[model samples]
Target: MNRCLSTLAKLDEEGYSAPALARLADRRAFPPRLEFTRADIMEIRTRTAAHMSISGVQEKISLRLHRGKLQPVTEDGEYILKPIPGLALPRFQEDVPANENLTMQLAEQIYGIHTAPNACIRLANSELAYITRRFDRRRDGTRVAQEDFCQLMGKTPESAGPLYKYGASYEELGQALRKYCSAYPVELEKLFRQIVFNYAVANGDAHLKNFSLQQTATFGDYVLTPAYDLLCTKLHLPEESRLAIDLFAEDEEPESIATYGFVTGADLLDLASRFGLIEQRARTILNDICDHRDKARDLIARSFLSDEAKVVYQAIFDERLRALEIRG
Candidate 1:
């Protein structure tokens, strides 16, 4: 199928977007014949699902909105919708959608980072689904050239070895922006804030592919894609390190490393300083993140996560925020 027109979605009252807010309010009322039950989604996975071509083993379906109704399609789509994965642990599975939805919302609304516009909607069976707009595709049906850090760094199993995406430090990404971005000084700060946000929220999965450079027709130069795929992985993987990958390129000084792959605010400041950012600017960003706890907690409570999961999410966030602030 040919996706000939770009989808136009409306910004929600809360700064997120979904098919319902744009023109499909009927989805909520009508029970979405176009939507699926979890079992139906699993069956579709066996049918040309690979043709949809996005990565991550999570159960996602490409969707096209025709005349205010959404239908699953392998091509010419505007949104990527995810149902709760059957593989997630039974105890924590219900929180996954809200965990992700709230984190992406928190990134944009509180931290001022641009993120893929998203919201939680329901399937016909009333199962929760997370839907996010496709930022890399234009309304005219042309794909914007976007490259993840893995591709930009020329990484592969042969070149960088297996698990290459997680093998490098985020500091390498900073080094890359310096080399490729025409406006590094400005974009550099955005990247810095994102890293800080990821740490504060306890996301242990911000690997190379989650960060990307996208070309915009207006600017004619590459800048960061709206951040997506953010969540508190710590809730599920309680044993996981505070970060998925290292934040620094060189070895940390003797005092820099903290517990559990954690780093200090000073460590983050040092990271910024190494990248030509001054100590004061680094401190400003780090402190701003730490100081936003009340707002962060508010968002958590308002999220779709179960009450217990919200408490756990907040606790993980508090633990990490304190870790960063304690070093100040």
Candidate 2:
């Protein structure tokens, strides 16, 4: 296996191949150099300033991969490329792209958590950026209508408050899914599974803005969008306790407390009932997460995260695994 954390494709005597990149991206060849220098990356970020509307402090630019080169796009971007964030806690900034790539792959490959298809892309300047294909955009270059949970719930900074998106519980997200999605039962289960997966991986930043309802062609209705921004946030914010938002409203239970408390199995069961999942269905999702521990651990070992970050990620996983397994 290529030790390079960016893509699964191997390097031969010639060099690292672009097979994975070719398959996933519009362009076949990797950027002549993963934009290697600070000056080059800064220039890309500057060009992207007008195009980026996504929330968060991470410096990223939406790009149109044109003729084997990533060109900054002010509109209709097909891919979002994020470099190691310039503004993040300490040492973790540099590793976040790889951390997210590893986490997204783990969710998709090991735990069956549907997430945005992503890979680590090397810049010509030697920088690494996490690149994910846009799930909302279609082949013809028309965008599928999609709304983040925040929009679905009518929670805007003007309407509710500055913290509006984070103010609601995860249960509220399920409620919105039920109301908006024509395929409620299935989406609800996916939502529940995602919560467990998020906890198991310590994605403390899986906030409302991070979840969306996308329009699928089979029916002119909404469904949970492919998961994105799924990184182990605990690696960066080690002291942070809460998992972005509450699992349920008024989730003041002692067990939900950070460090000592957790989003226990019972809490999930209760939420599952709210979403109308039968007992067996709920257990199946929980059991899958429990059963996949070894697989998850194995991937973490082979993950692209730095050695120190791997330890933190694994520790967070262990803590969440214990929380998910508890009967109460």
Among these predictions, the greatest TM-score belongs to 2
Give lDDT tens digits, candidate 1, residues 143-259: 999998988988877998888878678788899988878888888999999998999888889988788998878988988888989998888888887777787777444255635
Clashes of each: 1, 14
TM-scores, one per candidate? 0.88, 0.90
* lDDT of the structure predicted as candidate 1: 0.76
Off by over 4 Å in 2: 1-23, 26-33, 36-38, 250-260
Cα lDDT tens digits, model 2, 1-328, are: 4543444433542222454454356336545344344466568678667666756767777767777676767778877777777674855777888899888888888777777757877776556678877888887898899999888888898998988868788888888889988889888989999988887788888889999998888878888888899988888887776578877777555344554455677777777887789988998898898888787777788666778888878888887887878756
Q: Indicate the residue-level lDDT of 156 in model 1.
A: 78
lDDT of each: 0.76, 0.76
Which residue ranges in model 1 land beyond 4 Å of their true spot? 1-34, 250-254, 258-261
Evaluate candidate 1 by giving its C-alpha RMSD to the native, one decimal.
5.7
Q: Determine which window of 10 residues in candidate 1 has minimal summed lDDT.
A: 1-10
